[model samples]
Target: MNFRACFVLLAALVCLASPALAKTPVIGVNQFVEHPALDAILKGFQDDLKENGVVVEYKVYNAQGNVSTTNQIANQITDDDPVLVLAIATPSAQAQVAATRKNAHMAEVPIIFSGITDPIGAGLVTNLEQPTANVTGVSNQMPMDKHVAMIKRFMPDMKALGVLYNAGEANSVSNVRRLKAAAEAQGIELIEATVANSSEVTQAAKSLVGKVQAMYVPTDNTVVSNIETVVKVAEESKTPFFCADTDSVRRGAIAAVGLDYYEHGKQTGEMARRILAGAKPQDTPVEFQKTLQFYFNPKAAQRMGLQVPQEIVESADVIIGE
Candidate 1:
């Protein structure tokens, strides 16, 4: 070969091997379902990375509130071999964890989860301070005591409380157990309504009417994904509707004492950043949202045949619909 041709080949090889020309890291996001709260969590995670100047490409997937679909997405994500995986809800996290464990190559990839209520109970990790496996992220566990108290404050004469959830979701089941205990301690009967999917949510909400004075919904992906149906049922029946996340208050729930899901996502993202910067998921402790926000909607309360207590109105962190 000529000298000029030899020099040109070497230069081209160097350019191809340059770090600046490397492909962006891929983050696989497996969300259990599409809901305002879960969606906010994803937005916060991406925004945090962008704000910190971390550039990467995202491969996002939604389960559409189906368990089989979540498992399918998990397998696809494992095959994709992304740098990291972010599971938005408990089911998605569980599926990803299982899929990665079965694959030798994907097991090493970090899995970060957000919008989960009970990480320990969900079997994501045995220890919070030091995870026993390659899975750690934020837990948006709502205080059941505070939630029950808030419901009581809104309805002093409440004799029975209704809960709408999906039995398939580990996080929702965990929340229901906590909520049942809390309600029982307050001398309130807890009525349970379980649904298999979003299509069943309307009937579940309808069944609660006339049986309970107030209705409460946990951060169940299936139920929360179809929150408007419950809202309509509550409004028509004048049954007070409460939720476990702040985002639901804007969707016509009377009140909620829960985490700002967007902020919860940011917290999860911060943990992911650490993991990407050489922090192992097993070494990283599970984090919780430090600050909780109380949200109330006076217009929603009126529709539900209730008057917002002045104390709650004054103490709420956010007041929806004025």
Candidate 2:
């Protein structure tokens, strides 16, 4: 073959390999559902990477609030051979961890997670400093005591607080336990209701209708998605509702003081950048995000015949119309 023809062929091959040669990486993001909370997180993650000059192709996997779908999406994302992966919620993160543990293909891919309230309680890692596994990530952990405090502010004479959680979710279990402890410490009683899925939420809520003076809604995905039913039951019975997720406040809860999951996503991206830059997963510290925000819905408060205190109203980051 002539030298000129051989040189031309070599140039074409190099051009074709340019993507692999580039320092920028392809990142896979797994979102549990299309809920407003998780969608904000996806936006923050994408925005951070774009600003940092990192070439990232993100695939948002919506589990549609199904654990089975979360597992399936995790498997599909792992097959794409991304440099790293980001799981948006607790279920999605757990599903990704399960897929990576069982397989050899994604064994080396670093994982970052956001919107998870309790990474350790969920079995995602052994320690906060070092993950001791292929996965390390950020947590949108809300302060349980602070949440109860906010609840008390609205209902100064509050007692017999009802809490709804998904018994199957470790994160929910952890949060509920904290809620129980906090309620006891404040001289308030806790009424517990465990719902397996969205289908059972309304019935579970009805059980709490006349028994509890107020309801505490934690960051349970199942209950969060089915909040309208809970709201319907609670409002009709003059039972006040409180929440731990900011989105829940928008969805009709009386108030919320919790982690900003979207900011938590940007925090996740910072760790992801470090992992992609050759740091081991264990070397990076797992972060518990501290950006808690408060939202109060005066309409819901009025519906329950409750008046929020002046100081508590001033503490709100966002206030809804009454």
Candidate 3:
């Protein structure tokens, strides 16, 4: 073959053998801690995006239940200038919002949050219907009235209910406040034991042992990260332990009427899809989990010195530890 022919043939081979130079969008994720519910949410988020043909790269970060570390992670994510940010919990979401606001370069990067109990109360957004900013996501806010009624179902004659949570988490604080009002309306006194961090959770749970008939845990990252400790305390004390997330029921809580966090993450993922497809976060309304699921663990109930109600067993969406 002539030199010209060989050159053309080499060019063709290079074009065929070389990889495509398509740029995949990068998505930064800041998860506050590692737990069953939050892990499920991240899974659902990734699966939904994949199923919907939203090809992207992920830069995942876990704060491991540290507020300062969450802030640092958020700043690092901002510096990465990802196409978007997915904040898993209230603290992570708040940190991302703060970091983005401080860095003008990331001002346009949209943030979608999941597993947040109270977005408005967390200061993530001012209005749910009209976000009016570059932040909007899903709220896993449990129905306070329904939750109170559910708790009452297990302890009909209970005069007091104990709650353990981290007072610093805006979502937990909001949940506890609403729970208190609902409990009071039902003539049940709310006994609160606030913990500043996960290490303090066991002691906090012990404090409420005899003072209350049963113990409850909100969707607090700090409390949920160290849930087994609380479970141990409740099991030894014969105090029925309850949770606000269905995943916790499997982890040892007696029962819960809570959102399916996987579905909640998918909802947030849909919002993210829209944002990536040219929808402004300011125009997109914040979403909430549409369906709530009832879950129970018979063995957990037994360990906490309680029996699973027949009605609850029959009606539970998920019945584990049978």
* Candidate with maximal lDDT: 1
Model 3 segments more than 4 A misplaced: 1-21
- Report the lDDT of model 3 for residue 83: 96
Ranking by lDDT: 1, 3, 2
Scored against the true structure, residue 115 in model 1 reaches a CA lDDT of: 87
Residue pairs of candidate 2 with colliding backbone atoms: none
lDDT (tens digit, per residue) of candidate 3 on 1-322? 9999999888777767874644568999999999999998999999999999999999999999999999999999987779999999999999999999999988889999899999989999999998847899888988787888998898899999999999999999999999999999999999999999878989999999989999999899999988899999999999999889788888888889998888888888888999999999999998888788889899988888897668877988888965
lDDT of 1: 0.91
**Model 2 CA deviation exceeding 4 Å by range:** 1-13, 16-25
Worst 10 residues of 3 by lDDT: 15-24
Candidate 2 or 1, higher lDDT? 1
Cα RMSDs, all models = 4.4, 4.1, 5.4
Per-residue error at 243 for model 3, in Å? 0.7
TM-score, cand. 2 vs. native: 0.91
| Candidates sorted by TM-score, best first | 1, 3, 2
